[model samples]
Target chain A: MPTDKFQRWVNDLQKAQPVHPDQTKQTILSAMHPKRRKWPWIVSAIAVAMIIFGVSAATLPPVQEVLAKVPVIGKLFQSAELTIVANAGKLQGVNRTQSDNGVTIKLKSAYVQGRTIGVRGVVSGIDDHATTSGRNIVYHLASKSNHLHMNKASWNLQKDHAYTFELVGNVDHLASGRKIQVPLVFTKMFGKKINLRFNLELKAGKPVKVAFKGQTSVSGYRIKVLSAENFDGGIGSLRLRVTKPVNERDYLFGISNIHINGSQKDYGLGALGKHKSTKQSGIYEFQTVALPKKISSLTFNAEVADWSKPEIYALSELPNQLKVPNRAAMYQFQPASLHDNQLEFNFTLSGTTSSDRVLQNDDLPYLMYLQLADTKREHAIVDEYDTKGIGKNRIAPILYWVESSHHFMARVDLSETPFKDKTLDELELVVPSAFEKTRKLPTITIHNQK
Target chain B: MDDIILAMHGDLPALEHLLLENADYLERTAYLYLSNDTDVQDAISDTVLQAIRGIKKLQKPQFFKTWLTKILIRQCYRRYSKRRHDPILIEELPVVPVAGNELSSEQRLDLLAGLRQLNDANRQALLMHYFNGLSILEIAQITKLSPNTIKSQLLRGKQQLRDWLGDDYFAN
Candidate 1:
């Protein structure tokens, strides 16, 4: 029989089998029910007895102390390691509540560790419709002297009306053990604006800065570790310099699996600070997991990848498709036009092979470096601001998957680049590099000099 | 769709109705990944529990079936991965039902054996596309793969099935 016949046979088998079996439905329904049908009377009797006992137990100091010690932000730290850190930093005996327009926002606790400040709160009386809309409540933190730049915030509906929220971010400048008045602003809460202020004492352990000079070579690229710093929180920064290559093509360097004092935890290193490159060498800063108080050594794996040669395409070649060299992906460009000193176009990078991993939004920038260059060797690479969509009226490269087309839709803005003023006719599109095969170098360990 | 919206708002009856409506699809989809009847039932149960808990987080109401199938597939894969490490006795191997109306018991057994020979990704792609009548894009969404990958998997899966069963097993 043909495959279609097989499919039909399967379909027939599926149809012949009884759907909505009574046993399965009963099992699911019983699971869905709030209370079990079996032993209902016994469960209700036990619940009533517990309620009376709980009212009696609530007055006891021991029970009250145990209840108070229960972590309010326990759900925020799901991992055991993070839970330990959170419990150490958990604030005690602080409850600030602000209510307006039938909604209540209670500031439960806030802690400052290193440059990171975490705020946990509970929200109540929010509209259920708004919650079901799956839109986050827009909020931010403000202070007179310091600005709290929230990097991560999440809220979970604990019950019918209670929503637990946690916000963690790096503060611009926070003095250790300083009391600061922070006004939390909810710019949009289901079309309503609410603002609440709480007095928070910023207490963080002293930061330690260590200077060291060590060098390692990977794939001919010489890397020098300039310095390292550890703050109160297990967050630190590493500064490094890489000697520039004499060849026309450059190499993109990446570091991962950073270990401190031979710890198993991979203190993942992420690029920090602005990209600074000179003719001689390139300086890079990476955020790392801070070393413990008595740190001895640091180790990390380096990845080196040769950048693809710059491919200059004429403006007339718009609406063309090109296969990425040494990669299973296709780059398709739509028609390009200049708009008010900005070169705008929609392009898609789609996978061409089964094994090829589709590029996510975060991977788009690393896929290639785009630039607008003229006949003369002048070009402007996309800066950090352009990629982050920071400036007003600036359309930062918007990349989203188009379900209908089964490909990614990306709108990149070249408005703020140095080539913004250049006309499309005179300027050529330059793809400085598309990512290629990466080779991981052996882990380099650097011993600290006491 | 109305039931999905009501279910998202914590309507238990609406959620149960939706689950019952797609009960067979869920069971069959789970069975494709798991061979044991108990495992299939457990996968379905866990999928139902997760859906009931995370209904409000479901963004697209129209893709309820796809969302539920994705959950069921994950549960099935979890069990499948766990079962890989555990030792199984010869008697523990599932016996394929020999009674069928559209095909003889031998043919059904051969089909099941042939499908079992394919890799997990290819088999999933084939079953989701051909047996479940899901589009390539839908399969990609369910499996979190690119549509091109799904298409390639389906082609390779059909070829492999043909190689194992016979050249005429699949129509040109």
Candidate 2:
């Protein structure tokens, strides 16, 4: 067998020898056409560069000049017509569907607003559609003190999908050529379920046997927890979640911190696009538990503050490598330290008269995050985590990934301003993804928190 | 004596002869790239034709080998792009046996199959290394990469080739 293998290898080595053939220079001098190959690459690059920056460049004058001859190609670029009507108002050129440049768009919305309305229309034209070039696009709302709200939380669409929506309005400020990527944060469900509503209380200690029972008008849930660390001195929050059905629509529900019954530090965070809003993310689970309930299902519609007995079993947390060692993380406030003070917060869920159920997935947790925004003001690291309860009130201690055990320090004087009620909307769940489908072009309907 | 004669007289035809002599290796590069028998020949013919017309532009005679390598690689890419009508299923091609490092006709076809798994740049880097016997610096010059990058690519290519050939194949 070895001799047979040696013979086969010897024959292969001889066959693999380099074969040299002769050639002449005259035969090589025949093919020459540099003009044709280099131009297309240059043209494609110029078009891409022009589309990247807002200003038009030298490489694409022919695109602008020849656009006048193409009717469908011209409309999406040259000019857009704007008109406005109140709820049950007139829609001009009702059936006039137009295609311009490379964009084909029409107003398909028959629904009107009884209240003040705001919607923006953006277009990407021919030089874009004819050639596969990305365009510079963005959008901004014109109304100040306007709530850019949506009609529903879940809109029967998957992520990364784009639909062309056109709005004709007297507010010409919105019709500018701005391209924006869709956010992957929220999805719209059926009817009108826009943002989420959360109810949390910052009590002193853990409650015994906490039982949360309610029937949701819609199939949805939230997160709940007990916070032990206050900001600097007077600022604190008790986090929680109502875990239940989760789907694309659940992400659209945004939560706003209403108030701390008596002691809120007023963080002055009432601005649109600020990150200090509702703390629900579609990432992972905030800890949750379900006890036997008297009702078939609970409506997250009710949020009442009950602090009758908050201290049940002492907070006992899971020992994790992420935690600091030898330092007592969880703190207990003395009942005698202050007067009877309770936090009162009202959370509202808008969209489709709050009767939408197009989304139903009871797996993902509806989470609530109480981030310690300012720890530098206070000089002590209050990193704590434990679940303790005996009856109707349970406490989940504040948990954070502090530095390694020896180098961890937390400062807790977070009382310059306390928690006030905020609003969450369809835009809150979106405006973060890079696709074209989840663009939260602002609307004008202000969400009410009364 | 020969070094002085070559240094002073500097034979241009001899230099041209060297590039033309390596024409077969350049054709093999084009063939490996296009994978089509007809397009490979066309790319080789076009590379030789372009090289002759632009011989004056080849002023740096020392870079002739790398320059010729670029010509063939670019021609192969162009012809490959043109003839490519999206890849088809393997079943569409006739059942030709692959080349390998063996004596039989089937062995030659098997070795060609092993080359297809590499991305274009890796395949070109390997060809310039083994088939053309170019140094890492020379291969770097043709591929427009740094010498260290070429070294890394060669190291990675050897590991990848070993993975394809398996342990028993390389052990002996």
Candidate 3:
């Protein structure tokens, strides 16, 4: 009843402005008629054909050589319109103009960076003061059928009905020299739609050399640093293969203490996806914070926690006790309560001692798992949305709140665990170990195929 | 869902029908986020145009509602960012009292004023939950946050409102 009351209040508030369906429908239809009727499909087809042609042409040896020589300039050649203008040595002639219903839409310039295509152009039609109309001008990056829409750029209208628009869209993470189709549809209120198709070639930058590749183990967990690339924008993409099938939890805690060129940089638990062929391992994808300087021989470090080891405690050991020490801190754990397949624990972090020092620590450091006292099934503790007052989903099993600098209270709900209502075989407490190691990865060069 | 597919194929009537179906919803969502009448109207208009333009990319027709909601939210966020430097326009709205409802006009105003006082994240969580009647997971997907985060924000926001409206306001 209380919930219903809140619902009623919300419903009442929503009624503040009663929208007239017919009037709104009429307005939308009026805006759609001039634009949606004549164009879209044909333009998209032509654009696709152009992309095929452009892509085929880019693969030639001469083109690759040219692209290699002018990497910087190639980035500036974003759109087909711009590419033509660039090749012609006339940047000013890049503008492709189309006039329909007394308005002209011009494609002034475009360029592709990676898969992202950026377009800048102008729309000149209509009164200057009437530029900010209720009717929107939509720009489709691909085609109506393919449904690629680019919404990044804003159109700033100047005096005299002249509007400058910049649009950017991505072509599904394409590589350099690949070609993509972009269908630009300009629709204004009461004006016929203007469609322009462009087959854009991706500016290929030299692939960043993979400086390191090797297999290593940390805290009993096997991991392979498949490859690491140093790309523009100070970002580095690392491909990894870990012993365990990486889950969402791995994205938050799989990697830690990452340093590049012996200098520390901000890092997150990297994303791990299923290997194309096998589920036994996953492809770990993650990027490090902006590199401080050019990388020579880089060092990689992380705490790959092994939560598989189960520390069994009998019912007689009510309120089981466990302690695990990492490099800088000792983790003290005590089971507080267990019922209905739910478990709660009190964890205390003993600060660094003279013998060991942890560079830094996470506010919440432990990942959780559970097994029924009677069954062998082990269920990972996952972030539950049903629980109220949590703004973000907890992909990791560790549910905790800091009680003090060294004290934390944690809760685990086994309802969704693998064992669910089943009797537990044992309760396992998995915590990160303090053992630390840094691996100097060997560089592996990637040869570009001719 | 069918409407979205038809609209993508350049069916004007389907497009019109789809826009009409979500017209009230768009206005309410925009109004809640922008808290300005003019901005709400503008956002709704922009949402319609953008939705139609991008309809072909809707991928799955079943996701139409969520997709449309995401678009309107983007428009509302844009309007909010643009008006951030200006003082919140808490324009006086006439009370069209709901029949049989016990909440007084002053109380309603207090609730609205309290809403305006809350931060954007908290306010949005509450509005999405209550106004849109979306599940926590749905809200999380739209906001690109974890469901737990949405739940916590919702709880904190509800508490803040309860604090302002009196603890007994929702008491059974």
Candidate 4:
């Protein structure tokens, strides 16, 4: 059987000499070489003459004025090395360190903005650093009023003596313009723990309201943007209200292609809250970055059904990876490992599904739902492992998954499903379907609050 | 291949040899992404300089080919981004035979035209897989994407190409 002439075409393309390889090599090598100096004495004389000429050229008022006019050239002349120092903002340097058993933790810089508090530093003084199964360091931010911690606040030590430490955690729960004594706590290092406290003057920004007057309904789902606010640390929030939420095994259906001032902004996981009376879910999530200071218009595009329902097949029918087209986006599902009780798979999404090319900085979370049936019993696992409300499911695909400039990659764990009890021969994977039309909401304007 | 290990230890001659040997692969890969000869030349030069400067950072010497290829691809991306608005036309190049042993001249043109319709990432993925005979995992490493993503891109690219060149030309 012919494996498609496309493969044959590609094989033939290997022999196609689009560009002369040797010619390219020669050109590159020639370009890389510095121009040769014909004579040493002449070269030295020319260098001295050029230096004298350059001095006179610099002193002349006309040259100075022309150089001044070109500020970029003037900047180049001002410094031999071009290093632009950024304004570190109002955040002060803690410059604190803790030393124990020759291991030192140095606090380099700290800043507080809106709900995000970022800290950068270095851990040094260890002669030989090893990564063992149990030898791990955990960090947390604790204050009298607020407490936040990350058990897996991991850092990798480079070839250099210092271990790079950078941490950014949201502090939206705390009040702005408040002087808070936040303690930086560390645990489980060399069988010991350490604590460093810093006095931070936290500032939280007020969010601008994003009130869309007319709600847009798509496939029985009503969506509207409630409010948007700019916060410190280049963080912004968009509060959303969704009627009749779509449930997933791991995470909720998400919104994408959020354009503010005609530019799409990456979105993080929005905090989901269900109203006690109406049961309507209000999502309070932060944008990947802050919005511009002012906006004349804002548009929100939500993914109603991003993925197709799971399609089940026998073990023999399943390829290593199955690619299915969903409108503009192509979803590829690759089975990583299958066990009696657990199934793991990786998925990739590509193509121009939205107007905005999903940037590398954007975080796209996967919500996987798994259902398995066999002769003995039927089992279903809705793995909303991405959402916080579901369980202790802290399996963030954003951490393991990659959102490349070209596509999105994610891995799913379905160990808790009923696959463990079934026979090895055949089973069913429930197809969880989602529609893929990005609904652009009506453009709206919000007045600034006094 | 020992040149990679020698180059990792700051051996300039070995590094030069390794680069000269892989020049064809780099040029072919760069040409697929970039049309302009000047950009292709510039990308190769830059890739060489970056590879030399960043060799110590290479974790494994065995992956030296893929590492060099990755740097070259990134340089192609940079060139592509800079020259996006003002694309250097393929008409500028001197005439070269597009026809191969199996593909006719018209079919070759059709294939090239179809490739132009695809995005830069997909085109590169296809060329890397079929032309260079790189596995999905190798392509994944070079593209800095998951293996699954590379497989998807290759499959999608093949489908798009088949769509353009007629289904009869690419019957399964």
Best by DockQ: 4
Give the lowest summed-lDDT range of ten residues in model 1 chain A.
Answer: A63-72
- Where does model 2 exceed 4 Å of error? A1-450, B1-26, B53-70, B77-103, B144-149, B167-172
Cα lDDT for residue A359, model 3? 19
Compose the digit string of candidate 2's lDDT tens values, residues A50-118: 433322232211110000011111123211111222221322122223443334333233211111112
Runs of candidate 4 with Cα error greater than 4 angstroms are A1-88, A125-159, A172-174, A188-215, A218-220, A232-234, A244-253, A263-280, A288-294, A304-450, B1-172
Task: Kindly list the per-residue Cα lDDT of model 1 for residues A1-450, writing each as its tens digit.
Answer: 225776765655455433335445554565566467466434444544564356435532210000001111212222222233465554423478878777687877766544456677887777876566533233333332213444445567778766787665544332333333344544234334555555554444344655554666655667776556665545666767776456634455667778877889877635542233444455555666665555577788876555445566765465488677677666788877767865556666666454232132123333433344434443223222221232222223334333334344344445555556656565555554434345567777767664
Q: Candidate 4, residues A1-450: lDDT per residue as tens digits?
A: 224565676545544735555556564454334353235435444544564456435532220000001111101112100001113254446677777656677777665544445566677654442323212222223332222221112255655456665554543232333333444544323323444444443333333433332345555555544445554444555544455445522123355545665665533323222111122333334343456666555555444333323445543244544444344545555544455444444555555334422212121222332333343222222222211111222223221223232222322333443343544255433333332322343333233332
| Candidate 2, position A21, lDDT | 32
Candidate order by TM-score, decreasing, is: 1, 4, 3, 2
Residue A266 in candidate 2, Cα distance off native in Å: 58
Whole-model lDDT per candidate: 0.55, 0.29, 0.46, 0.46
Q: Score the docking of each candidate (DockQ).
A: 0.05, 0.04, 0.05, 0.07
Q: Over the stretch A1-450, how does candidate 3's per-residue lDDT look in tens digits? A: 226666666555566434434433443454455466245334433543454355435532110000000101101112332333245332322467777666777777665433234567787775433455522232223332211224244456566777776554433232333223444444332233444443332232222535454565444445665555543423345556555434422321245455655544543323322222122343445544333334443445443333334344443243333444334455566645668866566666565443322212221322333333554433222222211112122212333333234455555566664435533335434333322322222332222111
| Residue B63 alpha-carbon offset, candidate 3, angstroms | 4.8
**Tens digits of lDDT, candidate 2, B124-145:** 6666565545677766665567
In the order shown, the candidates' Cα RMSDs to the true structure are 30.6, 28.7, 26.8, 29.8
Name the regions of candidate 3 deviating beyond 4 angstroms: A1-3, A18-450, B1-5, B8-10, B57-63, B89-114, B133-152, B167-172
Error of 3 at A249 (Å): 61
What would the DockQ be for model 1?
Answer: 0.05
